[model samples]
Target chain A: MTRVFAPLACLAMALFAAAPAVVANAPAEATMGLVQRIFYYHVPSAMLMFVSAVVCGTASAAYLFRRSAAADRLASAAGELVVVFGLIVLATGPLWARKAWGVWWDWDARLTSSLLLWLMFAAYLLVRRYGGPGSEKLAGAMALFGMANVPFVYVSVNYWRTLHPKTSVIMTLEPGMRSAFWFCVSAFALLYALLLALRLRLEERRAEAEALFLALDE
Target chain B: MRVAWAILRKDAAVEMRSREIVYTTVFFAASCVLVFAFALVREGRAMPDAAAAILWIAVAFSGTLGLGRTFERERYTDTLRALMLAPSDRPAVYVGKLLGMLVLLAIVEAALLPLIALFFAAPITASPLWLAALLAAGTLGFASVGTLFAAMLVRARSRDVLLPVLLYPITIPVIIAGVRGTAAILQPVPDEAMARFWAALLVFFDVVFVTLSLWTFEPLMTEQ
Candidate 1:
């Protein structure tokens, strides 16, 4: 019980402690000064969204290979979290896009692929819910396979000219931007770990609840 | 090879006797033809180039109709698993079924080609060689994926609606690439710089996907 809340409490504490340091070290914006903080939250959320999907895919493949009920449950956990965070990223991403690119979307390879990944995983979640009891095996295989689209999206920018800004991974941005970015990265990564751990506990509790009800009925 | 040939022959023979493939394919083709008529009614005469586009669509759609029907034949005969367990490699089953579909598509196209000429007044300048080459390349790509998809959806809840849902988006790129190559070879636009390159792309996509589907089909079918 306490295990679920511990990390989340720690995350809240960490973010509050780090926030002032990030603000003090932040650079003066030339224009639209306050709108830039979105960079911190949005970029890290998007990165963690990718991390969640890769985790889902890896867990799904493990589920397929071992046929373990534990692996299946873990895959489901990753899938549901990916959907929650992927949607958050999608929602906040447009805010960043609007500020940075002056439009909500530009059909940039990353944007298109991210939307596709969200939809595909959303479909997997839907299938898991709606599919009959025996459907897990088939649905799991499908989720694993459909992730091929992720790599395609990642590569599409390089393969073809696109409207989205190419990844600025070179790290030449000024120190203020760099500091905020790293702070946000650590903050969100902690938040993600906390949320995932909590979610997995809830899933286990739900399974226990189901078993209890079934026992009572029996 | 001989066993596959036998299966192909048997399916063809039944198709011939019942006139099933022809009737459905022609009916579907006729309805699509009506769509073309209504769409171009203001023009009053069908353009040859337009005729070519409509021609392939009729083939593709009617081919879907036949695929849905053929995949279930073993189910109706009470022998789907039995057929799979036959003393033949899984690829033989895939190839034989795909060939059956190709034959049906060819028949549908042949019926439509002349009708297209008669209905639209198209001069049919596309030489037989060009048309044959186009059909050969295009059909291989279509049949490979279409057969695998039909197999996938057979166990689904809504097989009919689901087949197209599962198949079309995957096949869209191939269809566009193919029709572009077909159009290029047929029209021979003199100023265009990359006609052959487009055709080459079609060949590449066809080889890649067909090989991919063939390798993947056995695991897909046999997987628990």
Candidate 2:
């Protein structure tokens, strides 16, 4: 894992550096003009946010049932990434909505669920931080519950009607925009992977230090 | 099944003896209504759909209080560990705890409903059956997750604060459904179909959450 980290970091940086050029050269959207370009960043972060949530929930389940320390660390790392990517999606979203929807925000299905998902993961991190001893299990339960909640939240809020574009918008993108969008997505995915690896390593080192301290006390 | 029944009976007996949780939780819920009434009322009239929102808000708030106290009793007596060690199924204990929570919240809502109707001029009798179904399903969904999280938090530090922090975001769907379903029924021209739709959604939420809670309760409650 350590050996691959440096090269992965370089590749992610390179992709990220090249992403802006690709996005700029992509054909201007027919209607929304330059503001539509936010889609290149916002949609990718949104996709990765959901992906991070699944990773955290799966790892948390593994930790709970298998009692694997490595799984617990991975869950912690993924949980934090969910919040990070969620922030990017959220911040970039309102900027686009301001131009497109004539309002900074709306309580539509996707917007509401995205905010709630972000809050749930934020709460997950909070429990792990302030819950003291035995908090890991509590945090794991939180992740599992948070993951299970996504659909209910979506369905309930969706009753109010949605203004967010259908996800099919991606599949139907113009040729130039399609390539640019996928380019941005791959860059974001690589960044997500790099961050998860680094965070997991940090958790591993912290656990080691704690164990060593306990041994010294004995 | 018998294990669940016995635990429920035990909780009932304890509450029957003291009536502490019931009396306090109901009063707290009523107070919540009054507070909302003051904020939402204008020219001696409540805001539109204020009754439904207030009713569910009171339920959620007092439900949090009730959940915290119920587990606080077990933690205070150090009996949760004993219950976990008993020769019975773990999910049964979870069901028992969840049933107890539902009962407590039911009493709170029973007292809450008429007060909200009178205060806000909601037509509570317009559709009694749908109202009850919505309340029942919503309460079940909320309490199912609440019971599990509250029980797990029993040993954690600062549990009082942590309970709501962890419980609210997950249970927001229940509150949304409850408030919207009740609002549909309370409207001048009631929309029975909309009410039914929200009620069905609440049932689905209850089914998913209850099953998830039952499955996870054993492992979460196991002290490592």
Candidate 3:
């Protein structure tokens, strides 16, 4: 784990450095013009946010049923990342909306569901933090519920008409922009992996130190 | 089934003795409506959709209060431990507790319905059966998740504050469906089709969350 950390960090940093150049080279969108550029960062961050949610939920279930410390730590790591990436999606979304939709925000299906999803995971982290002892189990239940809730939230909010672009837009993207989009996605994915690994290692160290202190006291 | 029945009976017997939770929850829900009325009603007329919104808000708020109190009783008596020790299924206990919550909230909503109609002029009785179905499915959805969280928080620190924080976000979909369905019924024309869609969504939500809660109940309630 220690040996691979430096290389992974370097690779992530390199990709992030190259991201701006690729995004700049992509052809500007026709109607929305330059403001559409936010999609490169916003969409990829949103994708990773959902990915982090799935990771957190799966790890939480493993921890609950198997009571594995490793899984619990992994869940904790993924839970925090969900919040981080969700912030990017939520923040950049409005900037683009403000330019394209003539409004800062709308209660459309995609936006509302993403906001609720973010809040649920935020609640997950809150439970784990302030719930005192035995909160891990409680937090695990929260993640599971949060996972099951995504579809319901989406469906209920989607009953009304939506103004946000459908996800199918990715399939029809022009050639240059398509490559740039995937480039940013891979960069974000690499960064997500690097951060998850770093957070997991930190949790492992904390657990080890706590054990050492307990042993010394004994 | 008998285990669940016994637990429900136990909760009912206790509530019947004092009527404490029922009374307080009803009053709390009423006050919530009154507060909203002050803000949304003017010149003796309520804002659009305010009735449906206030009704469900009152339900969610007072329901949280009731859930906390219900588990707090068990924690006070240390009977939760005894109940856990019993040779019965944990999910059955959850169902029993959930049934108790639904009953308490039902009474509150019953009282609230007339109050809302009088105050906001909502046509709550427009489609009686559809309204009832919406209320039932929405309440079940809310209570199903609430009961589990309340029970889990029984031993946690600052649970009173934490209960709403944890419950509201997860239960927002139920609230949305309930408010929307009730709003549809309260509309001048009473859009039964729209109400039916939200009702169906609420039922689906109930099925999913109730199943998930039942599955997680045993592990969550088990102390390490």
Candidate 4:
């Protein structure tokens, strides 16, 4: 597993290196200027956060239905990645918000939802860690709810009427800005894959060790 | 339906004999209201303006306390495992527990309402019937998911700590609707339409969560 992940990790690092260069070279927005560059990191991390949530939720559902150890491992791996990418979003968000909204934090719907979603997944990890014997099933249950909550959280902005940018605004970005955003998104996607693969391998090894211990007991 | 009633009856009998959960939950909620009043006084915010937020926070905290103790009742006798092994459907257990919690929370809220009105200077009786309906729907949603997680965490380490951590995030929508609805109803001039909208949101959440919890209860309860 390390052998496979080592090269992928190296590739992820290379992509991360290239991402900043692309962002720096891309034309800045007229109004926000240099600080607007944070969007490249912010939007992609948010994208990966959603993608990781779906992966975790799907794997959790699979675990519940099939009771497969592999699925549990995959869910656990993605659950951690959800936290990782969520931190990136949370961090980059405020940095951009300070520039754009002139406040470090706004109780805007999208921002609040992202923070809540992050906390929900964080609780999943806590349960898996501290819940003891039945933690896996408990965490799986949490993932299902977390998955179900994604849409409500997204729609809550519309329901409440908030200052956050709408999805349409993201789609309407200028051509150069859009390509730079996608490039950063692609880089983050590769980074997510590498991190998930590494984490899944760790889970697999831990399972094998536990199995071996039980076998020795026998 | 009979199975669920039987379970509810059993819980009721036990509660009548001990009166343990009711007394404690009511007192805790009272203290919560007092704390909110005192804290808000220090901040000099109008207590009536925060009435909705205070009421729901009390319910969330006190409801969590009741859920933990309710399941703790089963844990003491090892009845939870027996219930799991029984031939009857597991969702019945969900229903029974949910109903019992609904009653317990209602009692706590009954005590809480007057205290909130007195301390916060809010007119809770302005639209009593609508407020009651909103509270009912909100409690149903809270208890539906709360009972499921409380049971799931029965033997878990540090469940007392973990229950609120796990519960509040998922149930935010319920609390949000409850607070908003209550706020609208308690206003100087109540907006019937706003109250109805929040009520509908609570109902939708209750239906979705209750149905989902019912389907997932068995698989999660099973050791296999």
The candidate scoring highest on lDDT is 2
* Poorest 10 consecutive residues by lDDT, candidate 1 chain B: B188-197
> What local lDDT score does residue B50 receive in model 1, on the 0 to 100 scale?
67
Q: State candidate 3's TM-score.
A: 0.98
* Clash pairs detected, candidate 4: none
Q: Candidate 4: which stretches are off by over 4 Å?
A: A1-4, B42-48
Which segments of model 1 are wrong by more than 4 Å? A1-5, A9-108, A130-133, A149-161, A186-218, B1-6, B29-66, B105-143, B175-216
Q: Is the docking of candidate 1 incorrect, acceptable, medium or high quality?
A: incorrect
How are the candidates ranked when ordered by TM-score, highest leading?
A: 3, 2, 4, 1
Whichever of 1 and 4 has more lDDT, that candidate is 4
Instruction: Give candidate 3 regions above 4 Å deviation.
Output: none
* Interface RMSD for candidates 1 onward, in order: 4.1, 0.5, 0.7, 1.1
Better of 2 and 3 by DockQ: 2
Residue-level lDDT tens digits of model 4 in A1-218: 66777787788788888888889988878988999899899888988899999999999989998899899999999999999999999998898888888999987788878988999999999999999988899999999988887665655444665776667867989888888888888888888888888789899999999999999999
lDDT of 3 at B84: 89
lDDT values, one for every candidate: 0.68, 0.94, 0.93, 0.89
Q: Could you say which candidate leads in DockQ? A: 2
TM-score of each: 0.70, 0.98, 0.98, 0.97
Q: Interface RMSD for candidate number 3? A: 0.7
List all candidate RMSDs to the true structure: 5.5, 1.1, 1.0, 1.6
